[model samples]
Target: MQLEQILRERKEDKDILLMTHIVLGYPSFEANREIIRQMVENGVDCIEMQIPFSEPMADGPVILKANQDSLAAGTTVEQCLEFGAEMAATYDIPFLFMTYYNIIFKYGEEQFFARAKAAGIKGFIVPDVPPEMGTTFLKEAEKTDIAPILIYAPTSTPERMTHLDSIAQGFIYCVARRGVTGKKSEFGEGFNDYLALCRKSTRLPIAVGFGIQDKDDIKALTGRADIAVIGSQTIRLVDEHGPDAVGPFIAGLR
Candidate 1:
């Protein structure tokens, strides 16, 4: 409930909240530090830090390349945990670790949960771990007070949403389209209906992710979704323009 309460309280003023994603060591930890400082300074509600998995299956080309490069550069789970702790303690916003389930499995679920809790991480978004396969993962998360965030795709049945809602905490990540992240998502009648199903199925705040780009996109989500997540675009901004470009880009989103 810590994360849920934070969002509810923060949402009292803003029509919609912003959440950003970063691969921990993509440019460099130094660049990560500067980017996060700017993000928090500019009023980002929360941030999800991806721990760079070799096979980030749900990600599009941009993020997939970041993960591969970070791993090739020898980024380790310990470094990510340390960085997470630093960010959480230094910034007021919530931080979540978004990675593949294999990372957790290899690190040992109990230890990962314990370390993440100690690091002050508020949630986990392991994209590939469905509830059926995540029984132990979810259990450890609950015991450690870490929200186990679950994803809902457009194809998910009403039954699937209900099942996911029963287990998810913090919020439900509603993938804006049928595919992976990066490509622009067109919001149409079908999209609205999909968001409606997401809202109806989960008491948790609905955060719409994949391909949410600028202010218009954020405006589009304002009433329909509680949080609008920005992922690959930010990474692209950092890559093309450098980490310093993140602040203005994020500021312009609202």
Candidate 2:
């Protein structure tokens, strides 16, 4: 099934769904494989396997460091793609390829799309490639059955959100705050208003990411958002603890 359909169907059983992001080959693909297993076994609904890049603009320190470290350690795009295929084949949950547009441009857009499709990847989260700049990327996404995940920021106007929804497929990744990933998010009045606009903007499921950590954060997104994304925190957990720490942490979120 398509990612949107899978996410929508998953929501029938749970009030909120969980999606996680991991920088492939951070510690190592060995650890990455294990991390994905723990996440999947502990009820993670979807996972975005980030192909590490040199300059990850959307990331904060933790993820930025991971990206740099992964690249420095000789992590290649082919390795990440192979790891993604392995995870998708092993886990029943939908897997997405998240990376910068430069990686796609260097790899050849349609070739990347074809490779991702062959790898069993269900979606692409190229944050740098907005629909306005990604005509071929969007078209290839449609043709290859890969969903091009669009993002909406807290500062986005209602009109802009509507425009995003027009070209967006799969789901809308609603960034919880104005900044990049890592810092913990505090859900309050402003967040509720932003979420309201997010809901009003798209028919696709809205996934609230950037600084979403711990059960309380997940609880806060319960009815308001369809999916709560866990990014840097998981990388932090793996760095601080080990791959085993992921399963228990994930199980307690809902």
Candidate 3:
């Protein structure tokens, strides 16, 4: 039941999985749990539990605010782990941690991956730590069997894609655009070409995120991508309409 295997199975069935993101302790611990339950019930295939950090450079305005607000409300790393452990145990889908490298560095990579594995986190999305600078981190991840998923941006060179393809585990996170997460992506011919290039690079499941919004966005990724990542938009909907809105919104996407 490793994450990579789950993704492969989904692909083999020709099912495009929905991968959702949530900033841990964003609104509150209790609320976050309910939100996750709703998402799973709505058919979310994987969950990315983002550990709120001070400077989440890869996040857009909405998620950045969520991170700051969570920190302001005294949401510590231990609380996130506790929340993650509970959710991972409750949900059958793959649970991965998405955070900046500094959090892992400060917490000690070995200890961090070990604790994440213990807490049922099957993988990680360390945005700042590219493969070249992640030798030790990868070593620890391999030892713990925690997949440190790599990312491929639209701007990545062929050589860069080849390098990333070599080490990517569970899945490859393909950022749809050049900027941070949020906004709506225009997945046209150019975006299709980018996805094609990414597919050529890695045999792992390619998850397209960063600006993915509605059902049309998911439809746009139907054949080319294995997973659709919806982050900021889902958070916004939950914040505006409460966690109850999440299930229906995800259902609409499906």
Better of 2 and 3 by TM-score: 2
Quote the positional error of residue 159 for candidate 3 in Å: 1.1
Q: Report the lDDT tens digits of candidate 1 across residue range 1-254.
A: 48999999999999899999999898888899999999998889999999998888899999999998888889999999999999999988899999999999999999999999999999999999999988999899889989999999999999999999999999999999988999989999999999999999999999999999888999999899999999999999998999889999988988
Model 2, 165-228: lDDT tens digits are 9988899999999888999998989999999999999999999999998999999999999999
TM-scores of all models? 0.99, 0.99, 0.98
Q: Cα lDDT of all candidates, in order?
A: 0.94, 0.93, 0.90
lDDT for each residue of candidate 3 in 181-215, tens digit (9 for 90 to 100) = 99899988998899999999987889999999999
Which of the two candidates, 1 or 3, achieves a greater TM-score against the reference? 1
Q: In model 2, which range of ten residues has the least summed lDDT?
A: 80-89
Q: By lDDT, is 2 or 3 better?
A: 2
Worst ten-residue run, lDDT, model 3?
A: 6-15
lDDT of 2 at 253: 94
